[model samples]
Target: MKKFLVLGVLFILPIVAYLFFASGVNNFAKLPVLTPAISDVTNFKSLSEENVSLEGKITVLSIYGDNVEGREGNAFNLNEKIYDKNYNFKDFQLVVIAQDGQQEQVKSLLNELSSTIDIKKWKFVFGSKEEIIKFYKSLDTNLKLDKHLSTSHAFIIDKNKSLRGRQENNNEEVRYGYDTSSVADLTNAMVDDVKVILAEYRLALKKYNKKEGLK
Candidate 1:
């Protein structure tokens, strides 16, 4: 009777272990801890004069110059998608970096966009052109900035200020392309990337709370 009971216990233990892993709980708990050394370079203030940081938010960053005025096709479209999908604006934000003198024009443009959607989560940050250029290079992106600060690319800055974007093993560009020709695909991919980043943050929060309770 004792041998039979021991055999039954061993069989049940393996099955329980398999089920636990199959449920994906194990994978979720083991999510990699992102520790990028990059610090937030957003020294500019928003239209409302609030300093920005990535301590508790995911950011989509773009540098807008004089050329950014009438040629913001991709930026405007991306904004609409983000606004429509992100019901909780606190979790996601869009940061538009412009030169110090461009604030009034940028604000006016943003106000026009606000007519269609809530622009509360949209932040227009202003700094010197030289200062902003240095900040843009720090992201390590591949997009070439022409006279207009025009580039088909934007970047994802995670809560930890670590840059997050898809990069093929041998691809030159670290970020997902923003070509207007493939606008649909690019937009969907970007939005999906943002969702994944947010999910990672939520999982990290849960793990932190669990550890705190144990202590």
Candidate 2:
């Protein structure tokens, strides 16, 4: 009886340990990660033109929702106002995320932006109302949504495809908390951030190039 009991204990211990480790591994595998392929989307072009992948290029995602301005079209655009030599982040991609109710307003804003700015550098996309809500929940971002996206309280995504920063066009110096007046400044900030990131990517890429050459 003693010998039989020892064998049972040994068998149960191994099985228990294996099951414990397997459970941990399964949990780790379920963790979510943002990848380039999932992050990649069709570029927003007003006409048939060249669309390039700005993977390594820094990008900003302009989201639109109920929190927009004047019920106008909400657009995600590249910040092109900065012109400092040190600030050379060039490849900027802007994805517009908006709800359906604001679709017309978003399109209108895009049209207006095109006329006033060379939005050729932007990639705007409008999301369903449900999708807009999901994005915030999934990202766990802290953005005060005013139910309209045409305003300055928009989110910005970084090149690594991770959301990096956000700023509302809340400059008392600028009239209208959210309007065309803030577009230039908002977009400019996006551009400036891209340049800073691009510079770093380029530097890392350079090191990689040299290392690969040696190999």
Candidate 3:
């Protein structure tokens, strides 16, 4: 009887420990929302003249400013590291905000990217300089756009139009955006965070469906 009891304890202990750690991992998988209810981009028109909205979508947002040509390297880096991996997610999008007159330059860039990539989920929206500044301000982040109205950094915006990123990184700094120029930042940090946010939504959806089924 004593031998049987010891065997049962040993078998059950491992299972319990596994379950406990698995729960912790799932809880940690959720990405934190830094800013809530960010402004939508529906007021602006895409390169195709269609209105774009941040609602109901997981967006990687960037401002390319007026020099779409100058930032060609940044665009390519983002395409390779980020969009190429997650573009197939139905609600995922890459929206670049550019000044209104840069449509031709944007078209040229798109033409080059399209030759080698699907480019369908990638969108470029145009707005007046004033409108662009106003929209950027609505994000309420600590970062600033450069003099050219561009930044090499890209941000994650969730389905609720909230800004998402690490509140404190390894350097003990608040990280609101990923540097598009750095492959390491995209590969090491942005990729994982994007997965987390997508998983967070997937779990919520699963719960919702299960509740509906129970009803």
Candidate 4:
């Protein structure tokens, strides 16, 4: 009787252990999400003035070719796509990381965003490396940055303000007959990259806000 009872206990224990472990085999992924690191945004005037860090707003940062005003027209159009056309502006944000010396250009861009009719709840940030690294350090270390990651390509940051995608730069500049295009035709493609980030941001916002009881 004793031997038979021991065998039964051993058989059931292994089965239960196997089932429990198998059910959560993929849970390690949850640990990688970590938390936001926006505290490092040092160069902005508003961080002290507004007493804010855009802690709750999603950010779309343009790390590219010109100052904010240089790209204001393009940004205005995108605003319509997100706010009016798509109605996805509840948590969307916009930032432009222009060249370090271009404050005047950035200010013009901000004015453009502010003047737009539907510019509600959106935040526009344009600043230096100190202010921007917070956006970068917030991302997964494995995520790649575009080699052309200057002040030209737009980077989409999640509500947590973690950068997810941006314009990629291919160092290889080639000539299509006489056009002289630097980077491959497939390198640093911005639109597709931003879309991928937006999808993930949508998922994160849904989960985070739901947990926080936000609508």
In order, the Cα lDDT scores of the candidates are 0.66, 0.47, 0.89, 0.45
Instruction: Tell me the tens digit of each residue's lDDT in model 2 across 1-215.
Output: 99999999998999999888655444432212232222443433322234544355455444555544453433422233432222234555555555555555555666866675565555545456556655555444443455453334444344555544333346633211122236565455544444444545565677799999999
Task: Report the lDDT tens digits of candidate 1 across residue range 94-185.
Answer: 77777777767886788778877777777777777787777766666556776866455666777677676766547444453344324675
Runs in model 2 with CA error above 4 Å? 1-57, 66-91, 149-151, 165-192
TM-score of each: 0.74, 0.51, 0.87, 0.44
Query: Model 2, poorest ten-residue lDDT window?
Result: 172-181
After superposition, the stretches of candidate 3 with alpha carbons farther than 4 Å from their true spots are 1-22
- Highest TM-score among the candidates is held by which one? 3
lDDT of 4 by residue, 58-88 (tens): 5554443333444554565555443333335
Question: Would you list the clashing residue pairs of candidate 3?
Answer: none
TM-score of 4: 0.44
- For every candidate in turn, the CA RMSD to the true structure comes to 6.6, 17.6, 3.8, 12.8
Rank candidates, lDDT, best first.
3, 1, 2, 4
Residue 13 of model 4 has an lDDT of 93
Which residue ranges in model 4 land beyond 4 Å of their true spot? 1-43, 52-54, 64-66, 80-88, 98-104, 126-150, 166-215
Backbone clash total, candidate 1 = 0
Higher lDDT: candidate 1 or 2?
1
lDDT of 2: 0.47
